[model samples]
Every structure is written in structure tokens, then in C-alpha cells.
Target: MKLFKSIIYICLITISLCSVAMIYGETRQSQWIDKFIDSFELTNSNFKFYNIKANMMIEKDIDMNELQNICLLIAQNLTNNKDEVCLKTEKSQVYVNYNDKNTGISIVGIKKNAKESYIIVDILNNKVYKNIENIYTKLENELSEYSNDVDINVCIAGEYTKKLKKAKISDILQKILYNMYAEKISDIEEENFLSVNAYSKLLKENNLKYLDREINLNIGIRYSEDDDKTMIYIATPIIKIDY
Candidate 1:
């Protein structure tokens, strides 16, 4: 099922961005992040944080000029930099870059086609920020002025350098899934990678179908040969970002 890399680009544009696939309410969105952090702690307390990403998709068409303006606004608001917000255009995407050292925020506006376009605001940080929820809520409210409907997807991820057997990784995955009260839908284990797709009622997030089965939680364990470290990622309503 290509669990590790399910998202693919077409025509130099991401036609099916994972951001639009996952759904969660603004009020309860933090539930998934909390659960993920809890799961990571439970499985291995030494798991160092990788990043926390939040994606917002505006479900309406926008012109390039307007998209650029929105991207700039988002960037300024995120980094509180009104001076000069760097924006770059590549193929069908316009990107806004932030210049913070500890926390990094990026906003991109993608033009899928003439009749369809969307803006994706992604907030990435190496360490967990206390005001992440507030930032998301504020951004959602600001974006609402442009489009009435906005879809939000969040993924909290971490990693650790420890070589463990497949059985041990499976046990960790099982503990995480069980803690979330998730029902396993499918799982794939390769020589160096293991992934599980499941659905958890406690998450309160929307689910997407995979191979005719409903799944809303995705857990992956991978062993890196170069660094010789194991990486584990947990996301509710399916992980939108590539591991």
C-alpha cells in the first residue's frame, strides 16, 4: 500500500494533498496531538521530538495574486514580520518562508488548476510550543474571512536512536494503538519499516477509507541505516506529512 509514501505529485503539483484528507474540529483538534505525545511518552520516554506540523487547506479557488497576498499575510502573522516576507514560486506553488531559528513556519499557496486552488499554512517547530493551539485558532479565524470552509490537519512526530527487534517495535505500536482504543484495520511490516492503519473512536476525528476499510490513525516505525536510529510517528486521522 506504499504506507510510507502515499502522497504523490502530478504535473508538478500536488493534486491530492494529505491536508484535505484529514478532518478535525477546531475545539477538539488538540486531542490528537495530546494523544500522540502521550503515546510517545508511554512507548518510550526518551523519544526526542522531531516536529509538530499543522496544515490548513482553503477549499476554494484563488488567483495567483490573491494567493500570494494571503500567503504573505499568513507569514507576517505567523512570524510577526511585516518588513519583508520571502516568497518563492515553483511550478504551481507559491511559498512563504519564515526566519525563526527555533520555530519555523511556512505558508504555501498551490494552484492545482485554473478552476481549483488552495492555500496551505504549515507551522513546523522542533520543540512543542505552548501557544500552538491558539495560533491555529487565530489563523483559522483569519482564513475564514477568505473562505467559509477550511480543513485542518495536524501531526506530532518524534524519533529516537535505538536499535530494537521487530517484535519490540510491534509491542510499542500495539501499546500506542491500544492506548488510543484504536481498532486495527491493516498493518504492513517490511525488513526495515513497519506501519499500521487503525481507527480510534476516542480521537473524535473524521476517518478515511483505505482498501474498503475505515482508518483514522496511522503509526509507523522505521529503522534508518545511515544513523542507525529508529523513528516512530503517530498521527490521528491519518498522518498528512511524509515520514
Candidate 2:
């Protein structure tokens, strides 16, 4: 009876740990959205980060003040210090920032309704050392208590979007497109497929008029194993911001 009781306790402890991990992985969705920020190294081992934003939603009856305090706890864990601030307002989310050397992690949690609230984590660092998905997963585990006995939805990601808007390759491609638009090519030429680097080489720096440089580039292309297959080009919409 003693041996059986010990085995049962061990099993219970193991099950508890597994349940916690499963909660963080299954309840948090936004971290998986982090693939948009390319973590590839420029050289053999050096890595840098660009602007990236990811969204996660929490379904619970939460208090603003309590959540803000929880965010402070998370910020402390992330930064290894007590430097944290909560920007609270009636309508806006309980925003918090963990001040760091580079642009730090900015978390904004907004209440969608009494039962649902959304949180967005925007990484503005010039270079990020760790993978963002991992970082947010850690954060989710820490904040899992807030989601106790509630409906939590986590989005899983298998791949990044092909449309280059806000992608790592977007800036360079936009430069090339600006040059073509500068020449005022009314007779838009269509190539079934072309390499991004090769297409940029076709246009010279002088060809760019600087007009429409701020326009968004929507590049959704997939490489096909079949040589005869062609990439499809879709019309891109230009979004204007009032601010």
C-alpha cells in the first residue's frame, strides 16, 4: 500500500506539470504570429530584429488594476528588474512597457467585453536575442493563472504569409517597385515569376522618382518545384493612414 501511494503521488505531480505546459501552449495564440518577424542571422551567427506585432486574446472576468499588476510582474521577469509602467485609461487597454536598452516589449491589454480581452505584444527592438514565440510562451505561462477556468484561444502557426506587407523582404522590394512606378510605366509588364534579388538588379537607382515610396508592397509568392509552374501576382491595395 505504501509503494502504491508513492507511485500515485508521482503520477499526480507529473500530470500537473504536463497540464501547465499544455495550458500555455494551447491558450495563447499570438506568439505563433511572430513568424512575421524574421529571426534569421545576417552573418553566420549574428541576428537582428525588425518591427513585429502579435496578438493574443484572453477570455476571463479580469480587473484592470489586477491585470496591470500582473503585467508588472511579467515585465520584471522579462527585464530582470522592477522597471515597469502601466498606462491606464478608461477605453484603452492597460498598457505596460518594460524599458530596456533597445525598444523594449510593449504589451497592451484591451477589454473586448466583460468576458474577453485582447493583448498585443509589439517588439520594436533593433535586434532581438531570443525567438519571440518562445518569449511570449514564457509570458503566457506566467499569466496563465489569470485565465484559470476560462476559454483561452491560442493561434497556431505553421508558416508565414507570402504577401510581403510588413515582411522582412518588404523594404527592399518596395524600393524596386518605386523605381518602376517613377518611370510611370502605364503598360505594366507582367512576369510569371522572378527572383526578388534578380528583379531589384533590373532597375537602377536613378530610375526611382521617390514618389509612392511609402506605398505598401503585397508580395504573395510561393516557389514551385515544377519549373513550368508560374507565380501568381495579385493587385495590391494601398492603405492610407490619417495619423
Candidate 3:
């Protein structure tokens, strides 16, 4: 009877140990989930977005602590202000948002093993998608070759009309300056220096006798060094001839 009591005591002790182990496992899982949710909220509120979805998967045998760390790393790696987006993670799910038409959410998934991990992002309604796609098509047509060094997947997604206008203006100014240098004639008379003969000659050469509209020509010159070569910078303004 004492042996029987001893066996019962051992069984009860084993059961109590098993129950404690189960509770500890549950608590760990709950804590891991809670941490992911909290971190997601903290990170997601900064950006505007339409929608977001994330799926994170880890091997069943992976430690909860390790899983949490991996999730955090994924979040850190994918979130950025240039995208104008925010992300939220709840357990294995992620959510994202962008403020308006200029921005949109992206969903990223992570899968990991002891040897390696993979990250996949689904940029749904992402502003860069069409731009990147167009760039890729153009690149393919131009190069007929693929380069790993070039990131064709990246794009600038924004309203760039103003930027384009500035660029065009800069190009036109450059062309105008180039033309002026090519056409410049030396020995221009200064406005302050009155050369009676040269001034009369200039007016006569320009056919000012029958001019019906006002004509004004202002010219100036400066010097600079470019690529170890002396460069002459010239400015000229020409107006219509007047009687």
C-alpha cells in the first residue's frame, strides 16, 4: 500500500510539472504575439495608406524569442519614409497605409529557417509600380541586356511636373549660352565709351535709317577657367529696331 501511495505521488508530481510547462509555453506565445502587435501600432501611424497585409512564418520548432527578433528585423528592413508609408504587425500579419494618391501601402511577407530566410513584398497600388515598369521596358529596349548592378525595380513616385519644368528651363539656358559663345564677335563697343565713327558705323550696318521699331543691344564679357582652358562668358540682349 505504501508503494501504491508512492506511485500516486509520483504521477501527481509529473502532472503538475507538465501543467506548468504547458502554461509557460502559452504565456510565451501570448507575449510574443503581444509584442508584435504593439510594435506594429507604433510604426504604422506615421504614414498614409490605403491597405496593408503581411504574413510572417517561422518553423514550428523555432524559439518564440527568435521569432520575435526576426519579425522586428523584417519590420525595420522594409519600413521607410521615402515610401511615405507605415506598417503594422499582428502576430504573422502586417498592415500598411499611405496618405493619398501619391502614396500607397505595401505588404511584405517573411519566411525563415535555420539556414536562410526570404522576404517578399507585394507592392499593391504602390506609386512606383508603373514607373518602374515603364523604366524596365525602356531599359530592356535600349540595352537588350540585364544588369544586377542597376536596380530597375526602384522608381521615383511623385508629381514631378515642376521638376521637369525646371530641368527643361536649365537645358534651354545651356543651349542659349552655347549658341551665344559660338556666335560672339569680339571688339564690342562699351556703352560708356562713345566712339563716334564706330557708333555711326554700327547704326548704319544695322540699317537703323529705316528701322520702324526700337532696337537695343547690350553686351558684356567675363573670363573663367574650365577644364584647364580659358573660357570667355558673354551676355547679350538684342531688341527690335525702332525709327
Candidate 4:
């Protein structure tokens, strides 16, 4: 049964990209960010992650100077150490870079374009010299402060490649399957089929407890050499991400 569940989860990971389209009310970029965060959150309590790049475009151009100041302020709020954040101006861009020497986590912000503007941030997960809250999450919260004006079109590419681990995938799969099963049974109401949640509820009545955890997932986009159309893969490789 465990092997079967593991196989099912692998398939689900491969197919999840397509299945996610049915989900409404969230932008693809935001969903992608959520998945990025979820992968780390599931494995460790305080694992830090870095970003490759994200787009933070506003409806109209805001003052570039003001925006750079905001980035500096956000960095200050996250740290007590002075000189941790250094500011610099390059052609058509202003940068705010943070170096957390204690934890080796660097959060960087970029404001681009001369007349119009947008923000690109890279969350670099340098070696975990110490435990710290994830940098992307902090910067994400900072972005929310300007939500009224900015049209967030953040997308990221992996700078650090990861090796997928099957054991980790299988462990997280149990939770994903249980949650999905619960949702299915609640809406469809099959006559003979009982959801894992429903069965767990029955066990709870008899003083036994069965509970499920949530899995953070994103759809895998697979391109095929044989076919022109790209495919969705739910059974994704479990990977260890590092710089």
C-alpha cells in the first residue's frame, strides 16, 4: 500500500501542473511563489531561500529615489547590524543589497527603467551559517506595503539547481493525497467511497486519531522532444536546492 501511494504521488506531481488550472482566484506568479516557499517550509522549520528574480511593476512610475529608500528601510527593519545593507546606483537602476553575515542570507532589490519602473529582487540562500526567517517572505511582506500602486508581476527562475529526492517526495505525498481525498469526498459525496478524512472521523469517534498535514506544491511544466506541446507533470523530482 505504501509503494502504491508513493507511485500515485509521483504521478500526481507530474499531473499537478494541469490540475492547478482548475483552481481559481490566484495569479500564476503568486501561485508559483507560494509553491517555492512551501517546498522549503515542509522540510525544515527555518530554512532560508533566495530568489533568482521577480517583477514588481507598478501601474505608473513612482519616484525611483523613493522606491530605493523603501528598499533600504525594509532591509533595516530586518536587521540590527549596521552597514549590512549597502546602496548603489548603476545606469538605469538603483540597488539595495543586504548581506547577513551571521546567516549568509543576502536579499537584493533592483529598480529598473529610466522613465517607468519595476522592482526585481533576488533572494540568495547562501550557506545556512545560522537559522533565520526566509528572505523572500520578508521582501514579499515589504512589497505588500506598496500594493495599492504596484501591479505585482513577480516570476522567478532557479539560480541554484536542486537534486530531487524520492524519499522526501513520498513523505510529502501522504499529506497531499489525504488533503486531496478530503476535498473530493466533501464535494462529490460518493455513496460507497469514504474519504481518508471521513474514515479518520469515524476512528476519532472510537478514540483513535488520524490527521493529515498540508503539502505545498506547484505544477511541473515538462517539454517533450517527441511532441511540440509541453506537458504537465505532477510527479516531480524531489530536489535539494543549493547555491
Candidate 5:
């Protein structure tokens, strides 16, 4: 009986040590995520994430299926772990929770453009003005030709700036993605929609006050050499807004 009791005590000690070790490991991961977020100069209001998880409010009328696909694509493309992607929708915004296994990065997607369209990005851990400036510089260099035709506006929302100072990451990822889309789509055939002509036609058809609101255009293309078929999904946020 004495020997059995001694063995049980030793097992209990072993379990306690294992539990402590596990907790420490989780704490370390959380800290790494927090640090990465802080590096982006994030604030509490513009974005808030705890334990690298966040909850957002999305409208009930929003398309959850399309949001999920985009979220999944982002996770697959940017993060090391695909299994970490989790999503839930509320009345106003869809909440996405995922850990950057490589960097403990947290991200959220807000505001859908169309059925499966959303603006999203990793929550920066610190102020992103420098990063934003870098992007702007790159845009200026790349868009030299369009400088005459296009007026580039770099407006940083006050709230976003405040959040950056507080080390809360916001949705700059969406902006970066949009910039990338712009670059890629511009290289595609000019005959596609969203050429200057298309924009003019859309504006005329809708009788829109184009100056009042910003327009976001997305053109998705998938080409199959076997069938000689190209599938294109062009999404214009302004058009959706008018509808």
C-alpha cells in the first residue's frame, strides 16, 4: 500500500509539470503574436485582439459563404496553418479567428464588396504610417504612367492612426490586396471591363456622382488551356452599391 501510494504521488507530480509546461508554451506563443501586432502600432479601438483571437460584428444580410472562401484563401496564402482558420458571423460583421502559425498574426475581414467580396488584412501590431508610406512610394513609382489619368489619394482614417499608435493592427491588408489587384489587372487585356471607357459608361448608365464616393474594381480571371475558356469574375463595388 505504501509503494502504490508513492507511485500515485509521482504520477501526479509528472502531470502537474506537464500542465505547467503546456501553459508556458501557449503563453509564449501569445506573446509572440502580441509583439508582432505591436510592431505595427495597433490600438485598442480600431482593432482589438486578445490571445490572438477577435470577434467582429457583421450584418445578417451579408454573404457568409463568399466571405468564408476569401478568408480561407487568405489563410492558405499567407499563413502556415490552414486548420487555424475559423469563422462565425453575427448581425453586423463576420468574426474570423486564425493564428499565424509562422508569426502568430491575427487578421479580420470586414465590409463585403459583393457576394464573395470582402476587405481584409492582418491586424498590424503598431503604427503603420511608415509601411503605408512605403506602399505609397511604390505606387507612385509604378503608377507614373497613370498619374495623369488617375488621382491617387492616400487618406489614412484618424481612427486607424490612433489604433496604430496603440499597437492595434487594422485592415491595411485589404488595401495592400487591392493595390496588388490593381497592378495585376492593369497588365491584363485592356479590352476587359474597368477600362476608362467602362468606367465612363458605368457612370453614365447609373447617373452616379462619381466624385462623392470611392470606387473599387476587381477582375478575377481563370484560364484553361485545355478548353480554351477563360472565366472572369469582375466585381465593381460601386455597381453593387448602386444596385
Candidate 6:
């Protein structure tokens, strides 16, 4: 009977450890969002949120076929039997796009690499802030089942109907950085675009280095003629989507 009790205790401890590993990168979502929203509010641009997106990369030495199948399963679980389109296929890559129009959930998956397969999952939605948090939390939980070592990037974007000048955009970026008490590591300004890379001790998420400086905040702004609006993207670590 003592041996049986010991075995049960071991199982319980194992399960608890697994649970902690699964939620590796989830504790800072609310903080990140609040910072993003509050910083943007400083601009006083009165922009409307375009979307909240998450890009997650899972790296493990798995076969391309296995990665593709896993991506398919993840999409199905995300969209609940929605139709998915195979966007592209190459010798070493497969891209799938899943859109559940009714739910406003768009998921794109890609399995690519010549030597070792890596999976990229992009999930986007224009829902309430709480809903966005819930969606990505579920996604992280699901992806953790496959690989504990996953890298995630979450971003929120907003747009103003009027186009702003390059100087104006730069001022906006500076305002946001100052509001967040972030250290500006690097910045670029083009005729129609402006971006700044920064680091802040207030953020409790992952960090990457650029030119020997730690960076966790990324702010970008550009004018889009297609939408007749000026777009702004704020992300932690970096922005993955094209401006």
C-alpha cells in the first residue's frame, strides 16, 4: 500500500510540472495590451483598432508531413469544422489559410524548411480585447501540446482615416515611447514610414537584442493609400506583419 501511494504522488507532481510548462509565455498578455492601448491613447489620434494578431513559431525536428498534419489539426480546432484553403505547396513548404467568416477568426499555417521543419501559425481577429486574450490563450495552450519551446509575438494595430505626414508619425512614436518609459534603441524614418525599436523594464515578456541592446517594444506607422488611412502597429519584441 505504501508503494501504491508513492506512485500516485509521483503522478500528481508530474502533472503539476507539465501544467506549468504549458503556460510558459502567457502571464503578460494583459499587461502588454494595457500598455499598448494606453500608449496609443497618448497620440490622441482617435484611431480605431484594426486587428489583434498573434504569430507563434514552433521549432522541433519533425518531418514536413507531420508538421503539415499538425497545422491542419490546429486549424480545425480553431475554426470548428470551417473550410480551409491550401494556399501554396512547395518541395519543402506547405501553406494553408483558414477563414471562419462567421466568427472573424483567420488562421494561416505554414510548414517550411529544407533541413528541419518549423511551423508558423498566424491567428488574427477583430474582436473585443477580452476575446482576443481568450483566443490566443487557447492557441498557446493547444500549441504547447506539440512543443514546449515555442516563440510567440502578439501585436495590436489601429488606423486613422486621414493620412499623416512623416514628421507627425515620428512625433507620435516618440510620444508613445516616452509614455511607456521605453528606451529607444533604434529608429528609422522614410518618406512615408516611421518605426522605432525600444526596450522597457516595465514589460515582463521575452526580449531580443539588436546591436548589443535589449529590445522588446516595436512601434511602426505608415500611410496606406489602399485604405485611405494612416496605420499604426505596436508589438512586443518585434512586429512580424508587413506594414
RMSD of each: 14.0, 15.0, 29.5, 19.8, 22.0, 4.9
- In model 4, which runs have C-alpha deviations exceeding 4 angstroms? 1-54, 102-115, 125-138, 148-171, 176-216, 219-243
Best-to-worst TM-score order: 1, 6, 2, 4, 5, 3
lDDT of each: 0.69, 0.43, 0.32, 0.40, 0.36, 0.68
> Backbone clash tally for model 4?
17
Tens-digit lDDT track for model 4 on 60-166?
45665777776677667656664777888765566776666433323334444544566655444445412222444455567667554332211121211233244
Q: What is the per-residue lDDT of model 1 for residues 1-243, given as tens digits with 9 covering 90 to 100?
A: 464355433422453444344433533566755665677677773434443344445555677888888888877876666675788988778998885666667777888877667777766666553455566657766677777656665455666777788688768878988788888889888888878889887664457779998888888777889898877777656666766
Give me candidate 6's TM-score against the actual structure. Answer: 0.68
- TM-scores for all predictions: 0.72, 0.43, 0.22, 0.41, 0.25, 0.68
As a TM-score, model 5 comes out at 0.25
Identify the candidate with maximal lDDT. 1
Model 4 lDDT-worst window of ten? 234-243
Query: What overall lDDT, based on C-alpha atoms, would model 4 receive against the true structure?
Result: 0.40
After superposing candidate 3 on the true structure, give the runs of residues whose Cα lies further than 4 Å from its correct spot. Answer: 44-243
80 Cα displacement, candidate 4 (Å): 2.2
| Ten contiguous residues with the weakest lDDT in model 1 | 7-16
Tell me the tens digit of each residue's lDDT in model 5 across 55-122. Answer: 23333344656555655564454445677767677653556655542233334555554432333333
Which candidate, 2 or 4, has the higher lDDT?
2
Per-residue lDDT over 54-172 for candidate 3, one digit per residue giving the tens place of the 0 to 100 score: 22233344443444444344333433453455656555434444345554434333324453332333333333322333322343232222112211121111111121233543343
The residue pairs in collision within model 6 are none
How displaced is residue 103 in candidate 6, in Å? Answer: 7.3
Candidate 1 versus the native: TM-score? 0.72
Higher lDDT: candidate 1 or 2? 1
Rank order (by lDDT, best first): 1, 6, 2, 4, 5, 3
**Native-to-model Cα distance after best TM-score fit, residue 52 in candidate 1, in Å:** 5.8
